[model samples]
Target: MQFAQFDVAAFLNAHWQKRPLLIRNPWKAWANPLEPDELAGLACEEGVESRLITSGGKQGGGKLALERGPFAEERFGTLGKEPWTLLVQAVDHYVPDVAALIEPFRFVPDWRIDDVMVSYANDGGGVGPHFDQYDVFLIQGLGRRRWRVGPVCDAQTPLIPHEDLRLIEDFEATGDWVLEPGDILYVPPGFAHDGVAVGDDCMTYSVGFRAPSRAELAEAWTAHQVDAMAEDDRYGDPDLSLQAHPGEITAEALDRLHGMVLASLADRDAFARWFGHYNSLSKYAETDWRPEEQMEAEEVAAMLGEGHGLHRNPAHRFAFIAAGEGVLFFVDGVCRECRGEAAQLARDLCAGNEWSGSPSEEALALLAALINQGSLGFEEED
Candidate 1:
């Protein structure tokens, strides 16, 4: 997909996370990558996460309904019947075409490009007026939907609470537009918007951004660091006096804890590895597969020689091979260590796209290992 010719870098530098900017026909002739039935089927699966929203009236001021993750098949029985909607998150991880549509936006940091969520709405369906903490670009796909968005001014503002959805209480729309297929609307954080499908079959793709809260980052990083520490020598408190004094847990001890935290983060390589692995992991449920048993090296080499394709597992964002010494191995987006021929082989595999011609002995071995570990495999073209 050719990106809209706007200076993405400049736009991002200027308005990203600051204000919303809409670009019309960003992807000319943009197609709906997944059909409504495919999406609904995926939502019904136990591994997939999904949500449903129903609104009461045309003005969108009515009873709200919500349901969350791992939805049951029976829940989708009335999908095409009335004023309701279903949203399936992280479609790109499973659908290659959908994932490829997002590659153009890789200019934005991987950490910021959260996931692609597809929403299918029936006539007069909406989730109510609400503001997101992160930025998003809503791409119109199947049909038309009217949207109204307003700026968020206060944190303590009241909201209309449904069973599982939080909607703004007194959202005043500053902008309104009808989105047709291929049209795009950018909404920055704190923009209260409500989208109601005008037609019976409307599908929209929401490319969401990640806004990690300070508390969330601290919790994730601290847990990772603590786990790493467990593999090493334990934190020692040599001065053990049985006397229980609340004041005795002095500022110095607190400082020591802080120091340990900083020390863990100080290893730049370790931190980068963690961040890369964390972001690359897929957010959606993936299909499980078992590799063919006892495949010979010659058979693997022959398959690679015949130009078999390799796709990175949706469940696995990164793969790494350990290299001795100071060398690090990075495949897809994951990091590890490698040396000599192994390092070269890893690079070729991670270089993106399909591999032509025969795979080297080392490459074949690596691919075999990846397949065995349920991380990657060869796909035969029909």
Candidate 2:
């Protein structure tokens, strides 16, 4: 489940977000985690993000086609055998073995990690040549896949006229390779790349990272700050003076207006707290991850007394930020201010450590709350 031999520092400094690097069977003992049939079953489940891409169109011998799922179980059998691929997003959220793959790549910060998207493709099957805005490490899990790496692309790059797929008009490969099981290829953001199965039953796991655009951050931050702002908190001109020209706005007025906006947005501490919650928000926010029955403090204490371990839910996000003597622990969009033993517990939880040692009463309460909300669960429950 971990890397056999690799230089993390060197890779980050020389290749990360700079260029593509091909790693040959880096795992100590590489084993395919999810079966093709298992992945297909996930595609047929509700609330699972999935896509079916057909090269010769859905009906066959036409333009490329894209179909969103939860698809009918019979649909897979009917798709003409013209090279199609089934991609299920956030496979790690559903598969524990698949989620363990992310642990090896923890050199990258937790928040930057998006999720592991697993795709199963037949011979000559691929989603087409396209560039992603975020970085991704493509891990070949089953069968061989021929990957064509092209130059970096941007908004100006020309695309083929396909309604669903944003395929490059004429992709030129700078490097090419056929990856076997356990092999990995890291593709930086905005780089054009294409992968097609060399033979049948090819499966690839894509561990993609989140690279929020400037506009996205600005918009989200603005929305958050606005929601907290009061209507009464408006621009004021206590020291108003008559302007020489009534039609012209004075420099003094402009400065005050600009300062008002900047002052409201320049709270680094407030932004840090807001971002901790924002970043910890689950990718699948619409899907409820709460436990079937609300966990009680008595139950949590009984389990802890029995020497049961606590673990995080892979589907939920967990992060913490130091605040004075305590920490702000954010989980699934909820933030809890932890002090003393609770603070230490938060650190341990984020570090993926199991419950150990005696915990304070406050710590037990926090644990119960987390378990009740489905952010943390007993190791046996997993």
> How does candidate 1 score on lDDT?
0.72
Task: Give Cα-based local distance difference scores for all models.
Answer: 0.72, 0.91
* Colliding residue pairs in candidate 2: none
TM-score of each candidate structure, all chains considered together? 0.81, 0.97
Best by the TM-score measure: 2
Worst ten-residue run, lDDT, model 1?
318-327
Candidate 1 is scored at a TM of 0.81
Give one digit per residue, the lDDT tens place, for model 2 in 28-146: 99999999999999999999999999876556565668999998999989876689899999999989899999999999989899999999998989988999999999999999999
Q: Residue 323: error of model 2 in Å?
A: 1.1
TM-score of 2: 0.97
User: Which runs of model 2 end up more than 4 angstroms from their true locations?
Assistant: 57-62, 353-357
For residues 1-382, could you state the per-residue lDDT of candidate 1 as single tens digits?
Answer: 6565657888879877777666677774577788998888888877677888865554656577777757766777755444888898888767876776666666665546677889998888877788888888898888999999888645787886555877888888888899888888888888789999998789998988887788876787778878867566545668745656766776667777778768876876676676666655555425454365746668777776676777655445543434344335543344656556656666655545344455567666766766665566677566
